[model samples]
Target chain A: MAGYKRIRVPRNTWNMWLWGWFLVAPTMLGLLILNIIPIFQTLYLSLFKSGAFGRGNQYVGIGNYERLIADAQVWHAVANTLLYTVLVVPLSVALAMIIAVLLNGKVKGTSIFRTIYFIPMIAAPAAVTMVWRWLYNPQFGLINYVLTQLGLDPVRWTTDPQVGLISISLIGIWSIFGYNMVLLLASLQEIPRDFYEASDIDGASKMQQFFIVTVPLVTPTLFFVFVTTIIQSMQVFDVIYMMIDVTNPAYERTVSLVYLFYNNSFRYMDKGYGSAIVVLLLVLIMIITYFQLKAEKKWVNYM
Target chain B: MGIASKAAKAAAYLFLITGAALMIIPLLWMLLTSFKTVAESTSMNPFVFFPSVWRVDNYTRVLNQNHFSAYYVNTFLMMFFRILCSLLFSAMAAYAFARLQFPGRNFLFGIVLFQMMVPTQIFIIPQYLMVDALGMRNSIFALVFPGFVSAFGTFLLRQFFLGLPRELEEASKLDGCNIGQTFLLVMLPLTRSGLVALGIFTALFAYKDMMWPLIINTSAQSATLASALAKIQSAISVNYPELMAASVLAFWPMLLVYIVFQKQFVEGIASSGGKL
Candidate 1:
């Protein structure tokens, strides 16, 4: 009986092991082919000048990288992408934090406000950008009309090189803050009621309690939101792509890394150069994330 | 509460109301403009608030003359398959990663995490090349190709699966159920919320996906709503009414779904925030 028990146990273990592999096989295979393999392939392809229709390729080791460094347009793209991230992340997060704190209180119409704010996050970027474009039109736009009503000169929202990135960033903040708000609100709710009660007992004012209790407790989530939002903003493509055309004067000022990669890879068919550009984007994200992680220990408080 | 607190609460309400208005004005403008005539839409001197005739012609014209219908069908088809595949494959893989013991599990999951960390553009060039090699361009299959495996869904669902009580699986095992049976009968049903969350996210991501469809399916007939809207915007840059109409048509389905599943959408998105 004991020998039979041991044999059955081993057989069951074998069966479980086989099933585990079977269950994971499809996803593993898909990721390997589509995602995992491609990372290396992109790295390799960046080395060679891609041939037409993806055929005969001549290896140009470090050549694409060299071109990427000297290319003024590539630098513009990097600067624009970073600037977009810089402009979008802090303002959106701060606004989201404020909104989340207010909504966390005994506020009426909380869900209604949430629903309205979140609409832009789910709306197709192409569609959202279209509406914004109409509104941002220098001539006959509602915004310009409003400006004229207020006795101020109508500002060129989408056309001007200086204003284009800012205009796109406004749309970025509008679309994204709701998502951050939801995240921050979730984290806010996780804080125990005891903390607030204790702070109140200690003669802490509402503002003081918020600064002393709420902010410290929510830092973990704040950190997460900041990291993810930065990564997301770094890859901004659709809104800019829809709003700014290559022929537009603001194209150089507004073109992001992903947009540049898209133009090079598909439009110009310079896949090698595009691959190199995207690799630079990947490195930048990793470095930023790495620093964020290292800095988390200093400010992010755990409860 | 003191008068000071009352004043603070009022200030909060004011701020929230203003923020909400800013959030919704663009959408309200889109809806209002779609019904206006081209002249009315572009009018600056008076700035038409409501359409003079409240025309449905823009909607009808876009639906009838352009590729809007095709975009609808294509986008729906792409979303449906992408959601279905991601749920099935991700659940299976997540179950294994969360519950099953296997060699190289950590290494494999590391790969998944690596996939999640990298910018999606890194995968695009090779994925495009792969689809081209398979002659799958300009097809629904091409649109649905890259989403067949979702590392994010796997990671998200694995967290859900891990949170389930282990005793249930033990009980099913003691009842003479095998590993597959235990997973299917005792475990899978418990992760319904996780499955739903993943599904909601997958659908949303699939719908708003612009670059892939734009790159893969260049033809009007094959384009998804997002890519098609982009095409029309570029094609008819100055036709404000038609463009607004196209924007409305492209986004209303998602808006409708959001309205109906408001609670679930909030919970799903919020849950993602927690796990991340």
Candidate 2:
């Protein structure tokens, strides 16, 4: 019988609607002006060529796209981006799963443990990046200090091109593992208590039960984390922005697509070329996302 | 059952404690370095816990030298306005999508969902240009405006609103309450957790935002705390202690907030992930 009554509006119905519209007005206006319009403008700007300071923009049909293909820097940025994503994503997700499983059991001071893991999640990225920058410093950094303590030679974390991407990935993993652990922990906990109980009754080993019950049930969340992490990892900016000074030797090896975009657009004020880089990034993201969506069915479990 | 279970639980606790220690190291280092003198901070020997000379001047110097107070004020203002706007806008749009039978409601809701997948980076350039066109560059509006329409918030609130029972709303309507009254009096109270989740998420993003504020606001007076912390890296070299001090001050409130709302954040993260 619930909700059977005729919906009679009050005398202030118009006012309610008005207020509702008003409440969303600024946000809607902002999305329109900032989000929608600028996308088109970026598209339009990409079709034209412009000089420094954005002067003398001339129309060129797909010429920017051709130039972008020939540009080794663009390709290097793409390769560097993929390398960063490849290095960071699997390590982060796997580490998160292990941590979440380890943390999922009944334990004394569970909340305290959760708080410790989540501290990094809540720590300001700039702060964490600064700390990581110090740790990655070639001299007197904690990381090198620890390495020397372990009787190993100190390696240049940011200065060496070969290790630079891996160094940044380590920071990325450090920042993201906590977040991914929290997410996977929720899914892990959702798994029925009876499943574990039944497995225990049947006398399966802990690792056996995890493989047979835990991993399969948590696959959906794992897949979700995987997709999101891939998408997010491709746009690496913060660690690079803070950790790698542009004047450093490993700058080219460490520059991501977004960093390159930032350099072209804001750093150098070459909006046209920057817009072209952005468009390529967008296309890259779209292709990745399209494949991810299509491939999600293969691994993602609904139940 | 009892003996083996207890043994397993002990092993689990040991693992969790190890993980906990690993995670807290960087943050603890930041806090420890904040109180260390310039000499001790970058010295060959790593100092744990108390410093040889407790130099509180690190904090004092950062607050005085770097415009920390203004950053705090700006960040606080940005978060307050951003949270208020997100709650209001997302709630209204969510209600319309969840309760009202409007044309294109489903389609519009779909658009909101689509927005969640499109990375905010894709929109940054356009958004920046838009802010420039609006002549609102270097203002608080630039900081708070783009974040107001949170598709994630709207989608989350919509799901929450949909999950709400209609009986209360019907009773309110029967008692001469209009749709607005029914929603306001009956529905709003029930959505407190949803609102809290959304509010907390918005506040966290607003607090931690570095990229947008760094892009738009060049002046330290109008800049956010995170951006100001980033400035410390570029501002000086070999001032690790002072930079760490600035970072500690910048992160303290967020850290405190996270600790206080730790349970809610876990619950929120869990539910929101499932919802996504």
Candidate 3:
């Protein structure tokens, strides 16, 4: 909007300016109310001891942060979230790349395969959570029944404290795979045919072309997938909340940062602590995203 | 060479078939288990894949028993308004940022970008407080409150608008059309694909959203399918068949959307990944 001189080519520019303001007002207002203002509010709420039913607020600046630092459950949730991210992020991207590369070939039923892969993405998360919870049932579950057929012991998918987080990560991997594959496939398609043809003319092996040409070309999308997946993994809530009940011994193992925020704010009526937890997540995401962006300069091949 | 090519094709088919099976089995498993009787569902000794008797009645029973039909209506209504309002606002705002030369345009757009970079979960507690203070809890407005405009949508659409030719806007100006008229009458039509993509994503996100609805709409009457299922999950602890049936019901609207707009849906994802 800054300029050296006012150069107008058309009349009624003032009216046009008003029109522009009118058109942009809704989203601007929405952003202010929904995003900008809430951020500062959450920061403010974090500084207080939330009163009865989250009514009164007695500010004890940085006290909530001090408590959160000592809170084992918060750290445990963070560790669990990071573990889930570590498990899902690389695995999802790698799986998506392999599947995308396979489907990139002029294979029979490619569209059908793509459609099938994306069906999980089509269903709501709640539905996915429900179905997986059904499958993870201890006694009557399909997975356990399958294990018995093979004469292997039925492992507790959601019940065991050791395996509960892994179980959540399994669904996380499954849900993310389709979207990542589609993106990687899109990135794969963007790789010019000339690169492959030149590699073929050079007598480069398929693996060599994949390593040298395909990977570099798809790095931008891969990086995008990586950042988004990890960020989302940090916010993992619904599946954990739905599948891991309060009675489950694995509740401690499977709780995510957002889930913990939900428990504190809504369940325990501890808004200040919940705000601190979410603020912590917000800071963690910002730092990771910062590093990702910094790394992109060296790694991501935009072209 | 011919033999190697043939082997390559076969290997590709094998890999894709296996991948598709992994992708589809859970959903197929859901549909199958939904038709089973509760006794059969819980009977691990036999390990039945299909129901001994076709229980299509399970769908009808779950739909009626848990106030699920009402929740479905509530979800669709909220989704419709959210999608409509969000699309309209995002498009207008995106066009403003992309095309108009307004004071503080870059600053405003920077704010939008900041919103995109921040995790949205941070806003939920305050958003909840706002809705509560307004006494709008347990209403559809609560569900739609925080989603009036999508930062992601505006950002994506702004990118789309930036790619449009300047000649179109110039020609509209030459014909005595103002910026607003030109945008609505001329520029808006050009971003159909972008709009459609935003619409699809918004609809999907709205449908998949669980926590907000669970928090705001405590009553099943105003709850969405996602929240309702979360409710039913805790309420009806057992009855695996009924739970499976409810999960299957949750996909019906999405199923309809997929059946109708399958190509656009796929293209939308493809282009979203490709364009950005």
Candidate with top DockQ is: 1
Tens digit of lDDT per residue, candidate 1, span A1-303? 678776645776777788999999999999999998999999999998876656777799999999999999999999999999999999999999999999999999888888888888889999999999999988968888888899999999998999999999999999899999998998899889999999889999877999999999889889989988999999999999999999999999999999999998888887988899999999999999889989999999876
Of the true interface contacts, each candidate retains a share of 0.82, 0.49, 0.78
Q: Write the per-residue lDDT of candidate 1 for residues B34-112, one digit (tens) a residue.
A: 9999888877667789998887998998888787778889999999999999999998999999999887889999998
Q: Which ten residues in a row have the lowest lDDT in candidate 3 chain B?
A: B267-276
Q: Global lDDT of each model?
A: 0.91, 0.80, 0.87
Which CAPRI level is candidate 3? Answer: medium
- Cα deviation in Å at residue B22, candidate 1? 0.8
Interface RMSD, model 1, angstroms:
1.1
Per-candidate RMSD vs. true structure? 2.0, 4.2, 2.8
Q: Score the docking of each candidate (DockQ).
A: 0.80, 0.48, 0.73
> Which tens-of-lDDT digit does each residue in A1-303 have in candidate 3?
445246563445666677778878989998999999999999999999896557888888999999999999889999998899999999988988889998897776777788888888888888898888888887888777778889999989998999999989889989989999988888888788999999999999989999998999988888889888888887899889988876789988888999999999998888998999999999999989999889989988876
Residue lDDT tens for model 2, A1-303: 345345465435655656455544554565666566667788898888776545688889788889999999899899999999999999999988887887787555656766677777777678888887777778877888889989999999888989999989988888888878888988988988999999999999988999998988988888879888898898888778887778989998999998888888888777788889988888888899889888878876787
**lDDT: worst 10-residue window of model 2 chain B:** B101-110
> What is candidate 3's lDDT per residue for B126-245, written digit by digit as tens?
899899999999998998988888888898888889989999999999999978789899999999988888888888888999999999989768899999988877877788788888
Which pairs of residues collide in model 3?
Answer: none
Give me candidate 1's TM-score against the actual structure.
Answer: 0.97
Ten-residue region with minimum lDDT total, candidate 2 chain A: A2-11
